[model samples]
Target: MDNQRSLWAAWAERLRQRFSFILQGQCALCDRPTSQVFCQDCTRRLQACRVQSSVLQIAGLPPLYSWGYYEGALKQSLARLKYGGRPQVAEPLGQWLAQVWLDSGLLERGLVVVPIPLHGDRQQQRGYNQAELIARSFCEVTGMPLRARGLIRTQPTTAQYGLLRLERYQNLSNVFQVGAALQKSPNLKDIVLVDDIFTTGATLKSATETLQQSGFRVVALFTAALSERQIA
Candidate 1:
């Protein structure tokens, strides 16, 4: 049954790829009528966030790069995909990350991209880790190996959205653990940690510690956006 299901999925994915050329649409981040979801201007804006960090970086974490703030159409798009079950949007968003990385020189310093992982229960519920979806797409384009299976959230703690900054850090301190991605990858050091967004920078920080403890020379925290840092 599993093999049959896999065969069907492969066929479906092939169909989607073959028919993708017939697609036409505007940008997801901006409203301009372009083949991609985001127009060139909007793409420029998101790419700019990569070089504009106030502090440049956190210790031992990769630089965070976002396509845009969690506002306007980007926010709604993320909402639809994250909560409304529109997983297809992930492909374009992933492409955005890949584009930003290449244009911004993020890949010049790092070889591996590891997406933040979800706990098994959450994976069962969502049937995906949104981070992994983006990472998989990113890996395909950048020619960088993606460690999608490593670093898991062992505990399902309360959502960090409601917690204060420090509280958010404390809440996630014990949440993530290094997974099989480490055991299997060759030359695992100097990894670029990828996540969808960085709010308090706690989740990525904790995950970095886990990987470092397991001997990875993590460099920076890279993401699609920065949430708490840009408050007015």
Candidate 2:
């Protein structure tokens, strides 16, 4: 049964990729004609937003790493991926993040890629979890094993968009638990949690603690975008 499920999932992913390639249209950010999610100009702009990982020093996050700052093209791209019904956008962004991680000299053995999950209700509404989508692409490029369900969101908390720091922390508290995938694979330790955005660090903090309490070591928090301000 598990083998069949894996085969079907691989087939579905291949079909999705083929369709995305064939149906390429306007850039998600600028609506300019392109064969990819973002046009060449927008892609260049997004690349320009890259920063050294050393610059991001949040007080409570695990060895944070992000592809770009959450402003300008990078910000718009993430918004389009998360809210504009464009899951295809995650492909290139995740690949770019993988490239950055490779160049950063942080690659290590025995690390598993785990995407921060969405609660079932919200995930059902969104049709997909952006973090999982991004992590899929990340794992594809980096050749790392992806445990997409290593953590689960057990509770649906309020959206953290406009919430203050205290509110964001409160909103995410007790929302996550180590998932069944981790339980089944006792050898899968030293996690790298992937998410689409890093705003106040609240979400990752809660997730890291949950995994830690469950006997897993969360080595890093990786994201596609990082807010320039601690509170975004």
The segments of candidate 1 whose C-alpha lies over 4 angstroms from its true place after superposition are 1-55, 228-232
lDDT of 1 by residue, 117-221 (tens): 887887788877888887887778788878887777889877777799788888887777777777776566778788777777788888988888888877656
| Cα lDDT, all candidates | 0.71, 0.88
RMSD after CA superposition, every candidate: 10.7, 11.3
Best by TM-score: 2
**Lowest-scoring 10 consecutive residues by lDDT in candidate 2?**
51-60
- Report the Cα lDDT for residue 89, model 1: 60
Worst 10 residues of 1 by lDDT: 47-56
53 Cα displacement, candidate 1 (Å) = 6.4
> What tens-digit string does per-residue lDDT give for candidate 2 at 59-139?
766778888888999888888888889898999988988987797688899899999999999999889999999999999
Shift in Å, residue 160, candidate 2:
0.4
